[model samples]
Target: MSKEVAAQFDELAALYEDMASWPFRHDIETPSVIAALGDLHGLDVLDFGCGSGLYSRLLKRSGARSVVGYDLADGMLGYARRRAEKEGLDIEFVSELQPRFAGRFDVVLSVYVLPYATSVRELGEMCGALAGLLRPGGRLVALPIHPDYQPDPDYYQAYGFRLIPDDDHDRPPRSDGARIRLELCHGRYQASVHAWYWSRATLEAALREAGMTDLVWRDPSTASDPAAAAPLLRAYLDRPHAALILARKA
Candidate 1:
């Protein structure tokens, strides 16, 4: 991750959970991630770029044999550790992906983190790291901001989110290093952070170069409970706000 991006997250570590609790995350993204993950029984799961270990704890509760959460920010990892201890959950949270963990996970989950790659090379390096972490036949499920995402006025108004593109262009196509301001408003709280963008082709090529296969794109609507995703689906069908990539290590 870029230092700028890491610093941005570090600053939001205290409020990350509260801002992430918005329906788009709890109701839409979480279910979508879990659905793409399929069964977790007895699997060694790794939550890459795990902020506050939300999905790490969820994986453990879902019967993962072992769960490890990795992040770049110290503050985020601290929060994750505290939450795990308080909940009596046996989760290992690490700041780095040590060599010992290579080829050790059955499933790897990354949520809203990949876009921080400022360049295609950085994205390829990330894919290679993810590939190395997974055992043969292991799966990687990632949720990143949709490369084709466009700010929909109505959707933003209804969902309490404000999209502020860094570029002054009316509507710019997906590009590496493109920055955008993501503003969130839930109840009385409001927060804004900048994020980098990546194009779909760039991501797909990187995954393939990293030796992944059977790539699949899953829509948010196909979450574990379609009924619960119905309302969110309508907005997504018009213009997807996120991308779910399911790939397997060969």
Candidate 2:
């Protein structure tokens, strides 16, 4: 990830935490991620790019034996440490992912991390780094902008967010490494950040080259009870901006 990307997210530290309870995340994103995690019981998990430690706390609460939240943004890590402490969770939050952590986790989970890669080489390095963090046969559960992402900035507006290509003229980005703008908003909270685009073919190639295999893609699903469902989330789920990629170290 670029220093600029990390710096941008660092500014969203507080707003990032508030997003945990935002409708889109609460009803859609988290459930899909947790389901992809599939039985965290007694597992040692790494919450990669864990902004404000949301998933880190969730993984621990889900019965993971230990959860370590790692991120390049010191702002996010500091806020995460504070949140984890305030909530009395024993999760460890770190600003670095050093060699000492290689092959040390049972699972490495990331939410909205891969898109930060500004180039194919960076993407491959990212995949390799995450792969190295895992032990033999360990899994990686990641979220990246779906290759089929909607180009209309307003398409997801009703779902508390919007996306638009970061181009001089508002045209859709058709190549890898093109920048995109992501804006998240709730009643009175709003934040925006830039992320790169990576196609499915490019992504899979990176994973495979990183020594990861058994790739699977899962669409977003609700954690809400059907009877208590909110209707508008359907369109977003059908064409989620991001998707889950599950794989294992080969």
Name the candidate that leads on TM-score: 2
lDDT of 1 by residue, 109-207 (tens): 988878777667888898899999999999999877787787543466456676667755544636566777778766775787767677778788989
- Would you list the C-alpha lDDT of every candidate in the order shown? 0.80, 0.87
Superposed by TM-score, candidate 2 places the C-alpha of residue 157 at a distance from the truth, in angstroms, of: 1.0
Give the per-residue Cα lDDT of candidate 1 at 186. Answer: 62
The digit string of per-residue lDDT tens for model 2 on 1-250 reads 7667788888678887787777778888888888899998988999999988888999999999999999888888888999899999999988777877889999999889999998898999999899999999999999999888778888889877888788655445856778898888667877888888898999999999999999999888787654456667777776788989999998
Clashes of each: 0, 0
Q: In candidate 1, which residue pairs clash?
A: none
Candidate with the greatest lDDT versus the true structure: 2
